[model samples]
Target: MTATERPDVRPANPHFSSGPCAKRPGWTVKNLENALVGRSHRSKPGKARLVEAIEKTRSVLGVPADYRIGIVPASDTGAVEMALWSMLGARGVDMLAWESFGEGWVTDVVKQLKLKDARILKAPYGELPNLADVNFDNDVVFTWNGTTSGVRVPNGNWIADDRKGLTICDATSAAFAQDLAWPKLDVVTFSWQKVLGGEAAHGVLILSPRAVERLESYTPAWPMPKIFRMTKGGKLNEGIFKGETINTPSMICVEDYLDALNWADSIGGLKSLIGRADANTAVIAEWVGRTPWADFLAKELDTRSNTSVCLKIVDERVTALSEEDQVAFAKKIADLLDKEGVANDIAGYRDAPAGLRIWAGATVETTDMRALMPWLDWAFAEAIASLKAAA
Candidate 1:
């Protein structure tokens, strides 16, 4: 079917932006009418809603019974920094870097925390550092999925069953779209704007029992920031995980997030959500198979990401143009898609070279993606021909 002929053609459905991804199916402002707008977050009703959001997320995500879930400030970055500042100094650290976010953490470790004995296992984008080479005995930090490069760890089997270190994971992009092995992770952090498609500004922190023990017993050598302090006087502040946030939160945003969680439940939870992501990505995978100019940015099929599917144009005809010209041509096609409203925000990440990055998260409908693919081919052909004529 032509892209214009498809009935499911929504400018919103085939959005495919990396973060603040497309909203949940049937999401609307009317769904959040009773968010206690005028009341304080410290009020009884507001606190109750906060607690419900945490508990429901735990149930929906299949977090272990022993884990504690909390809402934190600054979204995913805040949640991760809280764990790092509160727990890292007590043990040696092994920082893993495979993409932009991982490299951001490495910068935080060296420049921000100034940890003297940390070891970094680094790899180029689209590849993972050797998981087996990591020393689990040291506190470990990693991104479960590299959203920018569209690569993800195949599984969590490399984590030792009885390692002494705490595994801190930034799972902002992987939360609802992939199965998380809670037993293999100690501290996990994610933002509402990711898979859930809720508004940004808040983060969720899931702490395994071991992570709590570390927080209660060991303090970092550096002074604690007010937001990062999870314990006081060497004792865990259990209330923080219950509903008592470190600071105020947007009740409206909380209500919206709860709505997202409820929608997640309605769709048969994570398994079904994963199925949607897989199906949406499969549409792109099939397109890649037939298009001569297109290839996956991910090096290996097994490591290829189902959520953020990035593509590189490899056609020699396009490559015949100067490098700068090729990139400009690619940008022009992306702009055309955006202008026609056939797709929105599918440009590659800034750090990466010219290409397209499409988010196939659960919120995206596969039927819409199927309709959108042909339009991409048409736009690319038109843009390349124009560039050649100009040259």
Candidate 2:
């Protein structure tokens, strides 16, 4: 059935999934029509559009003057792997793990790369790996925002200015919603499908001068794949940052990203984008304050993520349910919201316990989130009543 035809049980509000977030206010069929389709990506027009996107992104995001931005192979994961495989091994590596994504990167380093000297700094989900414990003498990998647990580092003040090692940051959900202190970050990776609400498949890699030096000077002992190789014979590939993708890209996705970027610009750039996210999250924060049964999953207020707000049912009654029953109950509430179309994909990550995850990304309006809060309350109440009857 069409969106307009959905039953009254569904709240009249848009969805707030973590990735593939809600499209911008004016995103429409006509916008898609303007996208480049069935066009040669290597052609002048295609290259020009690509360059425009890169420049627009830099302008909107306020990237540093010397940094290079490249459109890489896979989404954020690919860009991050490329950086890790290319620039690491010259020095001892420090892998920080606080959530699933960070843990995945650690697995890649120790298990996949088999790096023997890597240092691991870990914390339970919803908390940060010790920032002060990090050794500035080694290359460090970290996620600026923990999407699954809804925790984030408050700022970059902890990073040493004179540190010798590169700081690789996975800022997938953090890029547009939060201010990036670029001076402290060396190699940063993100996807189009995140805060911009564009299509996925390609990742954006931003490299600092130090990162470029590493790429040109030191190569990983392991064999480099063509896609991961950013330098040839000790020289950086300048064209890659100028819209020359390593492989063929979907121009449709490119144009869609451009659409999102344009929308971002129209809304007054990063400030406005962050404002929307902050406002959307505030709605949830208010709800959390009033709802005794639910509380934020993040441990501290300063660490709470504005983009992906994770919540857990705090009622002791929920803990009393069998593990399977608790999962079933949470899934029932998620399915109820999904069927109603008030929200979709609010279920927490598989590694996380039975909980709810709401995307309060910039593209999602505060009004939409406000409307969605009641629906969540209703769905939870109804699901709990059903579970009680069954019990």
**What TM-score fits each model?**
0.95, 0.96
lDDT of 1 at 341: 83
Residue clash pairs of candidate 2: none
Off by over 4 Å in 2: 1-13
TM accuracy, model 1: 0.95
| Residue pairs that clash (backbone atoms under 3 angstroms), model 1 | none
Task: List candidate 1 stretches off by more than 4 Å.
Answer: 1-14, 320-326
The number of clashing residue pairs in model 2 is 0
lDDT of each: 0.87, 0.88
**Model 1 lDDT per residue over 281-362, tens place:** 9999999998788899889897889988888888887777776776777788789888888888888877766788898999
